[model samples]
Target: MPASSLSPYTLNNGTPTPTAAHSQPGTEVELQPYTGGDSEREVPAQATDRSERPRHIFSKHRKWMTVYMVSIGGAFSALSSNIYFPAIDTISKDLGVSATDVGFTITVYMIIQGIAPSLYGSISDSRGRRIAFVTALVVYLAANVSLAFTSDLAMLVVLRGLQAAGSAATISISTGVIADIAEPDERAGFMGTNAGIRMIGQAIGPVIGGLLNSAWGFRSIFWFLSVFSALVLLGLLIFLPETQRTIAGNGDVPLRGLYKPWSYYFKLPKEWRNAPVPPAPKLEKLSWRTIVEPLTYVLRMDILVLLSWGALVYTIWSMVTSSTTTVLLKTFPDLTQWQVGLCFLPNGIGCVFGSVCTGRLMDRAFKRAETRYREEHGLANVNVKSQHDFPIEHARLSLMPYFSVIFIVSMALYGPSYDFNDLRRHFAGNLVASLGLQFIIASTATAIFNINSTILVDCFPDNSAGATATNNLCRCLLGAAGVSVIQPMIAKLKIRNAFLVLTGIAVVFSPLVWVQWRMAEKWRRNRLGA
Candidate 1:
C-alpha cells in the first residue's frame, strides 16, 4: 500500500496515531486512539456540525431486545464450533475417512476461530457493523449449505474452517455493538447477557448435534444450521439496526442507504432532495491486518493480564466440556444419544443464569464501589473526575478470586478420579453431583467472563472491536491448546490427577487474578487519559 494510504487519518492538529505491526515492521503496536473515535462517550468537539451528524436511535428500541439480538449472534459462533462434536464418528463413517482425519476438522476450526475474528473486528471498526454482520452471516450460511451437501471428508474439513471464520466474528462484533450503546455502568449486565447466551449456545451444540445425527444424520445438522443462520440474517436486516457510533452516532442515526424502502425514494420532495447526507463511516488507515495487530495487545500489560486470565478460564471450561462423553457416559451408559445431549441442560442453564444475573450485578457492584469510594474520599457523589478516575479494575476484579477458587473446586468434583460409575452407582447420587458440578463451574466462569470482558472493553473504548478480537484470539488459542492436551494429561496422570494438575494451575494463578485487579486501574487510567 502507498504511504499515504497506510497513514492514519490526521485530525485537525495533524495528530499521528501509532502505526501497526504490519507494513512497518519495526514500528511497535502502541495503544493509540484512532483520530475520530477518540472517546466512546464523546464525539470530538471539532466534528460537531449538526447537519453532518447522524441521529442516535438507541432509545427507540428496548435495550434487552438489542442484547437478545447480539446474544444469538454470539451464540451462533459457538453453536457452529461445537455442533460437530457428537457427530464426529458418524461423519467419519459416512465420508469413509478415518476418525482422526475427521478430528482434524475441529483443530482447523479452532485455529480459524482463534484467527478469523481479527479480520472481522478490524473491518467492522473501519467499515460498518451491518456490512460486517451481514457478510459473516452470509458466508456462514453458505458454508453450512456447502457442508450439508459435501460427502468428501477433505471438502468437509475445508468448509468447517470457512464456517468457523464466518461465525467467530459474531462474538467480537457483538461486543462492539454493546460498547456502542452501553454506558460503562450498564455494560456489565449487557456483557453478562452476551457471555451467558454464548455459553448457552456452546453448551447446547453437542446435544443438538447428537439428537440431529441420531434421528436425521450429520447432514441434517448442517441443513438446520444453514436455515437457522438465514433466519438470524433476516432478523438482523429487519430489526438489528447498526450500532457503530462513528458512523451511526449512537442509536439514533438516520443514515441513507443503498437498500432503502420505496418510501425513501417516494420522499422526493424538493426539500428532501436538498438535505445534507449523513456522514458515512470515517475509515482510518487499515494497518491492523488480521491476527497480527490484535496479537500486539499482548504488549500492553493490562490487556495481557486479562487476556491471559480469560484464556486460562476458557482452557478450564473447554476441559470440562471435552470430558462430557467420558464422565457422562461412564455414569449413564444406558442413556440414549438424546439423553446424553440432554445431560448438558444444567450446564447451559447455569451459564445463562450466571451471564444475565452477573451482568446486572456488575452494574450494581460498580455503582456501590463508586458510592463507597466517594464517601471514603470525602468527595461529592457526582464528581465526574473521581468517577472517571474510579478504579474500574478493582470494581470488576474484587470478587473474582472467590468465583475462580470455587470454579476450580467444581472442576475437581466433576473429574473422573473415582469410579463415580461404581461409587455413585445409583442414578440419584450420580445425577446430583453431575448436575451440581456443571452449575457451579458454568455459573462461576460466566461471572468471571462477564466482568473481565466488560472491563477490557472499558480499557479500549475506541477500539472495542479490536480489543474483543484480541480477547477471542487469546482465549480460543489457549482453549485449542488446552483441548489438545487433555487426553495426554489424562493418560499420564489419570483423570483425577489430570484434573488436579489443571485445577492446581488455576489455584496457583488465583492470586494473579487479584494482582491483575490491582494493577489494572493504574494502567487503564494512564493509557486512557482518564
Candidate 2:
C-alpha cells in the first residue's frame, strides 16, 4: 500500500490503516490498503472541543487588580507627604523653628517627590515593574520608620526626601502600568480613578494627622505613617505583578547605544554572543545626550512651553490654596484641628465628583466624534484602535471656560470674604474653589496624558516608557522648582496678590489651551501623519 493510503494506526501485521471517521469530511469512507496479508486496524481522529483552547487565566483581572493596587499604594504614599500639614505648627514649635522654615520641610518633600518619579519611571522601564515597586516600597517603609524617631529638622528633611523617593516610584510606575494595560479610550477613566484615590488620600491625610497630632503629639503622625507604609509594602510585595514588556535587546541597550548604530554591536564574535548576557542594569551615564534626547519632544515650539507654563500656574494656585488653609484655620481660634479636618471633607467630595464627571464627558465627546466620523464617511462601525485619531481639543474645550469662571470667582471673592464672624462663607468658598481646582486639574491632566502620551508614543514608539519617563521627569522637576518658590511668592506677594498672579498666568495660558485645541488635529496630522 502507498504511504498516503495508510491510516494513522498500525495493524497486528504492522500494516497502517485509515479510519472511516478520520477521513476528510464529505468524502466517502475508504478502507486502508494493507501491504501485509493481515487485516489493518483503524484509528479515530483526536477529540477536540472549541472551549478547550488555552486562554489567559488572569487577563480579565489583571487591569483592575493592577490599577487598584497602584492607586491605593499611590494614595497612601501621597498621604504621607501631606499628612504633616496639621502638625506643621506643632512641629515648628518642637523644633524651635519658624513657620516658614517648617514650610520648607514640606517644600523639600514636594521637591523630592517630584524629582524621583521620572528617575524611577526610567528604572521601571529598564528594570521590571515588580522589582522597582518592591524596592521603592521597602525604601519607603524604612524611611517612615526612621522618620518616626527623628527629632531634628535636618533629619526630618533627609528622611522626608527618602520617603519622597519611594512614593515617586508608585506614581510614575502606576502611570506606566495604566499605559500598558488600558486602550487609549479607557486610559482617562483609569487615570481618573487613580487621581480620585490620590485625592481621597490627600483629603483624609490632614484630617487624620490632625486627630493623631491632637491626641498624641506631632511625633505620633510618623508612627501612623510608618504603619501605613509597612502595610503598603506587604500588599505590594504579594499582589503587584510585573508588567513591563520584555523585548530582546531592550534591557541590554545602553545610554551610548541609543546614539550608536546596531551594526556596530551585531558584528561581534560568536564568543561574545555566547558570553552570558548580563542582567538589566541602570543607565547612569547621564549626559546631555541622554537628557536632551528625552526632552527634545517637550522643547518643541508646539509642546513644552505651553505645558510647562500651565503646570507652573496650576501648581502655584494649588500651593496657595494649601498654604492658606492652615493660616485660615488660625483665624478661627475656637476651631480645633478636628473642625479643620471637617472643613476639608467637602473639597474631597467635590474633587471625586468633578473628576468622574469630567472623565465621562471627555469619553463621551471622543465617542461622539468617532461616531460622526464614521457616519460622514458612510462606513460601517468598526473597532477604533488608537485614541490618537480622536480630536484632543474636545478634552480641553470641556474644561477651560468652566475653570476660568471658577478661577475668577475664587481669586476675586473667596479670599477677601473669609472672616472669623462668618465661617459658613469660608466653607462655601473652599468648597467652590475645590470644585474649580478639580475641574481645572482633571481636564488639564486628562488632556495632557491623552495628547502627550500619544505624542510620546508616536515620537518614540519603540521606547514609549522611556519617552514617558522623560516627560514625567520634566513635570516633576518643574513641580519641585515651583514647590520651592510657591511659599515665598505667597508670603511676599500675600495671598490676594499671589492668587492674582496665578490668575494672570492662567488667563495668559487660557488662550494657549484654545490654540492647542484648535490646532491639535493639524499638529497630530503633521507629527503623527494623517
Candidate 3:
C-alpha cells in the first residue's frame, strides 16, 4: 500500500497503533517508519510555534519599564558615588573635615558599590527577583534618608555602604532580568537600551549633585537621591513583575524544600517514585557556600572568564574618565554646576547612539556569518539555531582599533596649556576620549551579555534565573575591584600617566580579542557539538 493511503490507528488509551503498511512486513508494527511528508512539515510547524509563542506577561509591556526603572536606579546609585565631587569643599567645611577625609568617603562608597552586587546576585537566585529588588531599594531609601540628617563623616561612610548594597544589587539583577526575557539576537538591543538609560543617569548625576550642593548645600544631594530612590521603588512595586522561572516548579514543593536534599535523607513518596529528581542546588546553605559556588562557577566557565575580563578592561578605561571629570572641571573655575552637567550631555548622546548602532551591527554580523556557514557547508538548515553561530570574538576584535585611538587621544590631553586655550583643548580631547569610551563599553557589554546569557541558559536551560544570578555574581565581583582600585591608582600615578599605564594594559589584552576570534569557531564546535 502507498504510505499516504494507509490509515493511522490508535489503541484504547489513544496511543498510536501501527499496521503492516506502517512497518516492514516481518517487523513489529510498533516500530513504524515515519515516511510521510506531513511528519516533516509538522516538525517545522511545531518548532516555529515554540519560537513564535507570545512572551510571558512580565516580558510583554513591563520589560522596558523594568529596564527603565533599574537603569534609573543604577544612575542614582552611581551619582551617589561621584556627585560628592562638586560638593567636596562644602562637605569638608560643614563636617569640619579635610578634603582628604571627604574624599575618603568617596573611596569607601566605591568599595561598597563593587562588593555588594555579587552578594545580592546570589541572594536573588534563591529569594526571587522581586524580593531582592524591593529589599535593596528599601535599604537604599533608608540610607539616603538617614544621610540627610548625618553630619558625622563615619556615619556618612556607613550609610553610603548600606546604600551601595541596594544600588549594586539592582544593577546586577537588572542585567539578569534582561537575560531572562530577551532572545540571543535581541539581547544586545535590550541591553544597549538598558545601558544607555543608565548612562543617561550617570551623565546627569554629577551635574544634579553639583547644582543641588551648590545651591541648597550638600545635604540636598542626598535628599534628591532619596526622592529618586522612592520613585523607583514605587514603580518597581507597581509595574515590575517577577521574572523568576523557578517559581513554576510543582506547586507541592516549597521554595526552601527545593534547596534541601531529600534523596540522601528520605525516600520519595509513592507519587514521586517515577518523578525525575532535580540536580543538587549549588548552595546547600547561604553561608560561604553561596559565595564560593558562584565564584567556582565563574572560574569554570570560559564565557564567564571572557565577560569578567571585558568588564575589568572596560572599568579600567572608565576610571580615567570618572576620576578626571572633577579634575578637569578644576581647570574651568568659571564653569557652574549647571555647566558641568551640560558637559556630560555630549557623552550621554554618544552612549545612546553607540549602543543602538553596535547592537544592530552585532546582530547583523552574527546572522550573516551563520547564513554563510550554512550555505558553504551544504548543510540543511535546522529549525533551532546553535549558540556557536554567534562569535563574541568578532565583536571584541572590532573595538581594538577604536580603543587604541582612545588611549592615544586621552594621553595627549594631559599636558599644560595657556589660558582658556588649554581648557578648550582639554574639553575637545576629553570629548573624543569619552566618545571612544562609550563605543567600547557599549560593544563589549553587548558581547558579554549575549555570549554569557546564551551559554548560561544552555548550561542550565531549566534554571535560567539561577544561571543568570551566578553570571551577575561574577561580573559584580570584578566590577567592585575595578571601582575600588581606580581612585588609589589615579592618586599614585597622576591622571595623564595613569591613563598611559592603563593604555599599556589595554594594548597587552587587545591581542586576546584576535585570539578569541581565530579560535571561536573551533571552540563553539567543541563546546556545543554543532
Candidate 4:
C-alpha cells in the first residue's frame, strides 16, 4: 500500500514513513494494528491485496469453483505418484527390471519432489501464479507422455524424476494461491479442504491405477495421468485467472498472458487477456543458491521443530500405507493388485474426514482464541486481528492432544495386531485398528503441517509461496528419511516393536509443538525487526 494510505500506527512513534525507494524486504508494515475511528487495518501488501481483485468471484451459486479448480491442481501432483503405485510391478516387468529397481524410482521421484517446489514456489511468488502453474503442468504432462512412450527402466527412472519436477510443485503453488485469495480467518478451512482433496486423489490413485492396469494394461495408467494433467493445464490457462495479488493488484489488475518461462506461448485476442497491467515484482535470478534456499531454512529452530514433528508423523503414515501390500499380502496371499488398491480406501477416507473436520475446528478455535485475546487485552475491535496477535498455536492445535491420543493408542493396537502371520485370524480387530489409526493420523498430521506452514507463510506474507516451499522441502526430506528407516526397524526390531518405537518417538517430539507455540509471538517480532 502507498505510504500516504498507511495508518499512523503503521510506523512507530517518530519512526520515518516507509517508502518504496528506501524500504527493503521485511521492512514494510506487514499489518497495521487497529486504531479506533477512521484508521483502517493495513495488511501486508503481499498477503493483503490492497485491491483484492480477481477475474473470478465465488458467488453463492459457485462459491467453491476456485477451491475445486485449485484443489484439482493440488491433487494431481499427489495423484501422479499414488496412481502409479499399483502399476509399478507391472511397469517393472514390462521394462525387464527388478521390483527393487522399480522401488528406486520412488526415491528419485521424492528427492526431486522435495527439491523442485522451491523453484516453482519462488517463481510463483516473484513472477505470477498462472504461468508457474502452467509451466509445471506442461513439464508434468510432457513427462507423463514421454513415460508412456518409453518402456526402458533407466528412462523410466529419469522420466519419473522429471514428472516429480512437474507435479510436485502444484501443491506448493496451489497452497500459495489459496493464501493469495483467502484471508487468514478462513485459510484453515481452505487449507484443510485442499489437503483433503489431495489425499482423496492420493487415496484413489492406486485404485484407479489398479483397475486401469488390470483392464487395459499399465500403459493405460500413464496415458490416463497425462490426459488428466493436460485437461487441468487447459482449464488453468482458460478458466483460472491470475491470482498473485502483488501482480494482479487485487483481482482487478489485468494480467498479461506471458509471465516468465511460459511467456513465449500463444497470444490471445485483445479481450482474452488484460489490456494494461501493473508490473509484477522483479523476477528472481534462478541459480543454485535460489534452488537450495528453501532447504537451508531448516536450520531455523521454529520451522525445524515444527517440521520435525510433521515429518515423524508422515513417516509413520507412509510406513503403514507403503507397506500395505507387503504387510497384508502375507495375510491374504491371493490378493490381487486391484484389491490392494481397494485396501487403501479406508486410509484415504480417513484423511478426507480429518482434513475437513480439523479445518472447521481450526476456524472456530481461532475465533474463540481471538475473542479471548481481545477480551483479556480489553480491545474493542475484536474483528481486527493479526496472525501475530491471534493465539494461532492454540487455535490450530487445540485438537492436537485429542488427535495425538488417537495416534498413540491406535499405533499401539495396530502394531500388535500385525504380529501374527495370519491377519485374517484377527481380521475384524486389525481392520478396526487400521481404519481408526488412519483416521486419526490423517487428521492430526495434516493439522500440524497446516498450522506450522500457516505460521511460516504468515511470517513471510510476501513470500507465502516460498514459505510453503521450505515447509515442503523439510517434510519431504524428513519423510523420505523416515521411509528409509521403516524396513530397517521392521527387520531389526520386528513389526510390533518397530511401531512401538515409532509411537515413542512421536510422543517424544510432542513437546516441540508446545515450545514452538510459546515462541511464535517472539519469533514473529524478531522476524519483523530483522
Clashes per candidate (backbone, < 3 Å): 9, 1, 1, 7
TM per model? 0.83, 0.72, 0.70, 0.84
Model 1 Cα shift for residue 322 (angstroms): 2.0
**Model 3 — TM-score against the truth?**
0.70
Q: Any idea what lDDT model 2 has?
A: 0.57
Cα lDDT tens digits, model 2, 348-370, are 55445554555555566556766
Q: Candidate 4 — worst ten consecutive residues by lDDT sum?
A: 25-34
Clashing pairs in 4: 51-250, 52-250, 52-251, 53-250, 53-251, 53-252, 54-251
Model 2 regions lying over 4 Å from their true place:
1-62, 247-293, 377-390, 393-401, 419-476, 481-494
Flag clash pairs in model 1.
55-252, 55-253, 56-251, 56-252, 56-253, 57-251, 57-252, 58-251, 189-359
| Full-model lDDT, candidate 4 | 0.69
Output the lDDT of residue 12, model 2: 33
| Candidate 2 weakest lDDT stretch, 10 residues | 47-56
Clashes of 4: 7
Instruction: List RMSD in Å for every model shown.
Output: 6.8, 14.8, 11.0, 5.1
Candidate 1 deviant stretches above 4 angstroms: 1-57, 96-101, 258-275, 279-281, 289-292, 330-332, 373-388, 416-418, 423-429, 526-530
What is candidate 1's lDDT per residue for 1-530, written digit by digit as tens? 44455444334346532333221231111222234553322222222332233222354246678878877977888787667767766788888986557756766787789888888898777776777888889999999999999879789879989999999988888888887776555678779878888877767887898899899999999999999999988877766666676665554445557222234354542433655666664566666464366668788778778877778887788777666655555556676667666767677777888888888877888888878876877655232212346666777776688888889888777665345657655464567666778778888887787777787687666567877888888888888778777766766777677777888888777766876877877765565554
Model 3 / residue 271 / CA error / Å:
29
Deviating ranges (above 4 Å) for candidate 4: 1-63, 259-296, 378-389, 420-432
Model 3 gets an lDDT of 0.55
lDDT (0 to 1) per candidate: 0.71, 0.57, 0.55, 0.69
Residue 386 CA displacement from its true place in model 1, Å: 8.7
